[model samples]
Target chain A: MKAIILFGHGARDARWREPFDRLAQLWQEQHPSTPVQLAFLELMQPSLEEAVTTLAAKGATDLTIVPVFFGQGGHLRNDFPVLLEECRGKFPNMTLSATPAVGEDLAVLQAIVDFGARAL
Target chain B: MKAIILFGHGARDARWREPFDRLAQLWQEQHPSTPVQLAFLELMQPSLEEAVTTLAAKGATDLTIVPVFFGQGGHLRNDFPVLLEECRGKFPNMTLSATPAVGEDLAVLQAIVDFGARAL
Candidate 1:
């Protein structure tokens, strides 16, 4: 089975995870077949490794990690790859892949533009 | 006149601002009448004050700042208000307002969900 992990740059404030929780909920609701988990880079629970372990134990053979950040900074370019490599080494049985930060998506950018337009 | 500023948490990598630049471009293209500018919270050029000043100079009497961040953590709840207050003090004549972070928008979140679904 396939699973998804919505990864984010976690913040100190607990409230910061609200949208992330909402994202996971939406994913589970819409894609019931594909299990979803939330993982954070730092300062939040369920690091990438933990999330991957959970999914792998749940019978997820293939997993896609989506970076929910708006920018592909050092975290994405540097830190994330190392983390993924570690996960890959630990879980050689699972097929793991990642997509670019959500901000790179045209539709996501368009949604932000639309949000700004509506606010104006 | 009215203008918009796309506010973001800047990163050390200059390339991280690509989406922000695209956002400003899309705004200019779609809303030709409303001038747009990009501002960073830190580690980037053109802080909020600079963007506001530029817009004010461009005959913008009303300005709307859209936080491109995904979460309203301490940065938004604590730091952002203080910065906004300073900007307000400097440009009292210009009406400055802000919308919630783009992440809070249902449409933006939906776009992210769709992006993840497509990647799976």
Candidate 2:
């Protein structure tokens, strides 16, 4: 089965969950059959390890990793690679290719500039 | 005086604020006596409007808005500009120059790529 994991920076204020959870829900709506999961680097439950394990448990050998982050910061650069290393060890049989972070994607920048124009 | 407003997406888990708060503290340490303010686009208090006014209230006519966001997501594209427009009406005397969102700027991309290389 194909499984997708969306990672986000964890937060203390509950409101921070709105977008993450909303995106999870929305992405699911768009891809109904894919097994989707949510993970955080810190300060939350269902971390990267847990999310990977859950998908593995469901017999998802094809995994698409998506970081729901705005930019490529420490988490994207350092933390995620380390997480992926552990993931490789745990799910040796699974095939994983990470989607570029939201920050690196061009469509995202377009959306941002398009929206920011209102300020002018 | 030059005042800077650092905007971040607030979160429920305190860990989310670490980078934001830490960056704010770091910038202040670098530029002592140059009034700096922290605000959130959402999920936190002392929001954009408040931050602008706070800087204005402190008699800061030259405002440098540095979005602490990782990318040019919704806040940079949508909310921030609207906030800035209102700021114009409120603080017309203030000279505002917004740096490109952290996402569009090349330095940020290098940081993300440098960090992600570890995963390989």
Candidate 3:
């Protein structure tokens, strides 16, 4: 089965994980039975390697890595590439597709407005 | 000069700070005369109180606190408001207007698309 991994920047604050977990749970509510997992670049557990290996062990040959970051700034474009490169080396035979980081979606505009969290 | 405070979730990993700092610098580049400061909600240094106190000391009466978070998730909508409430009490006479958190702007759509960080 295909697996989706949500990668968060990972924070030390326990409060920080709440939203990420909530979103993951919300995503699961829509995709019940879908194999989804979480990985942190740092400051948290389940490093990218750990998440990838776990999914691989579970027979997920086709994997999708979604950067849970806000923009395509350095993290999504630069650091994440490095992270995925390492993951790619580990799962060479696996077909992996890295989705654009969050906030890269046009649809998110309304969500932002709905949240009333917009500037200007 | 006007002042702006960018509040981050504060990650334990050094890598996570790069983007926030970079953006702070970029914003500075555009507004050379403006005094921009960085604060962390947790994990990092320069807490909200510190950032605000520094600004207040510098004669900033009309302040605008910008949540550097991605969405209105718990931190932006919940925790941050609480932080501001505390600040409001501290600066009772100060006029502070909080802009929407980042990613809440329609203009950010292009940045997201430009980053090619979209999932769908």
Candidate 4:
């Protein structure tokens, strides 16, 4: 089975994770067949390694992580890969991969533009 | 005239502003009448004050700022309001308002979900 992890740069304020939680809920509601998990880079619970381990235990052999960040900065380019590699090493049986930051996607950018337009 | 600012949490890596740049470009192309500017909270050029000044000089009396961040963290909740108020003080003639982070929009979140599904 395949699973997806929506990874975010966690924040100190507990309310910061509200959108990430909503995203996960939306994914589960839309794609009930695919198990989804929320993971954080820092200042949050369920680190990437833990999320992967949970999914692996749930029979997820092919896993994909989507970085729900606006930019591919040091966190995504530097810190995220190291964490992913560690998870891969720990979960040797499961295949792990990741996508570029969601901001890199044209559709996501368009959606943001639309949001800004509507507000104006 | 009315204008918009795409405000983002800047990073040390210059490339981190690519998506913000694209968002501004898209806004300009789609809404030629409404001017748009890109601003960064830190580690980048054209701070919110600079962006507001530029738009105000361009005859834009009303402005809207859209935080291009995925979450409403301390940066947005705490730092951003101060910056916006400072800009408003500096450009008292211009009306400045801000929308919630782009991630707060359902369409933006749905677009991210679609991106992840396509990648999977």
Q: What is the DockQ of each candidate?
A: 0.88, 0.07, 0.11, 0.84
Task: Score each candidate by Cα lDDT.
Answer: 0.95, 0.68, 0.68, 0.92
Instruction: State the lDDT of candidate 1 residue by residue for A26-82, as single tens digits.
Output: 899999999999999999989999999999989999999999998888999999999
Candidate 1 Cα errors over 4 Å, as ranges: none
**What residue runs in model 2 are displaced by over 4 Å at the alpha carbon?**
B1-120
Query: Which one wins by DockQ: 1 or 2?
Result: 1
lDDT of 2 by residue, B91-110 (tens): 78888778765545444434
State which candidate, 2 or 3, has the greater DockQ.
3
Worst 10 residues of 1 chain A by lDDT: A19-28
Best model per DockQ: 1
Q: What TM-scores result for chain A when each predicted structure is judged separately against the true chain A?
A: 0.99, 0.91, 0.89, 0.98
lDDT by residue (tens digit), candidate 3, B1-120: 357787878866666666567666665665566566788898888998888888888877766677767556667767888888898899887776788665454444334433332342
Model 2 chain A poorest 10 in a row by lDDT: A111-120
Error of 3 at B115 (Å): 1.4
Error of 1 at B2 (Å): 0.9
Model 4: residues >4 Å from true position, as ranges? none
For candidate 3, the per-residue lDDT at B62 reads 68
TM match of model 4 to true structure: 0.98
Q: Give interface RMSD for all predictions.
A: 0.6, 9.8, 7.1, 0.8
Q: Could you give the TM-score of chain B for each candidate, in order?
A: 0.98, 0.85, 0.88, 0.98
